[model samples]
Target: MCDMGQWKQSQHFFEHLLNDSNNNNEDLAKVECSLGEVLQWTGEWSEARKYYNRAYDRMMNIKPTRIKDLAYILFNIGEILYLEGKYEEARDYYERALAMQKETYSS
Candidate 1:
């Protein structure tokens, strides 16, 4: 749905998945991240940040923390900040995500 540019449908699907009782923390985190991406695509910066933060929090609570996924969320959050004109904060997040990616890929 997202690949097809169906933002509304993608948002609906992710929201439905988010509310499902079967979702574990990791699943919820991924869904939240996806939903945030949908919101970001629609230019809903604040809402996107909220969902990204939720996803980041959930991802952090899990075991063996997913570095790549965390980096992705961070990068996306940075993009939102950039869009909102928070250049310094956006740069900070982008640097953080880049550092993580470098560390992950280098080793």
Candidate 2:
């Protein structure tokens, strides 16, 4: 549903999942992050930021072991920051995401 360019449906699905009262469901967090990416693509930065922040908060607490997922999210954040014209902050995020990708591949 999310990867098919169906941004509105993806957003709705993720919003439902996030508010489902299931705090331990990591899948919800992942979807929320993806939804944020879709929102970003649609130029809805403020809404995107909310979902991204939610996902970030959840991911921080969970500390996902998948470096690829982490790196992707970081890259998305960097991209969003870049789009928002926060060059320095975006660079920092991009650097971090790139470092993570490098580390993952090197290992």
RMSD of each: 0.7, 2.1
Q: Give the alpha-carbon lDDT of every model.
A: 0.96, 0.79
Task: Output the number of the TM-score-best candidate.
Answer: 1
Clashes of 2: 0
**Per-residue lDDT of candidate 1, residues 1-107 (tens digit):** 89999999999999999989999999999999999999999998899999999999999999997999999999999999999899999999999999999989999
- TM-score of every model versus the real structure: 0.96, 0.82
Clashing pairs in 2: none
Worst 10 residues of 2 by lDDT: 57-66
> Per-residue lDDT of 1-107 in model 2, one digit per residue for the tens?
65688878877877777777765746766877878888998899887877777776677667556667777788888888899999999999889889989999998
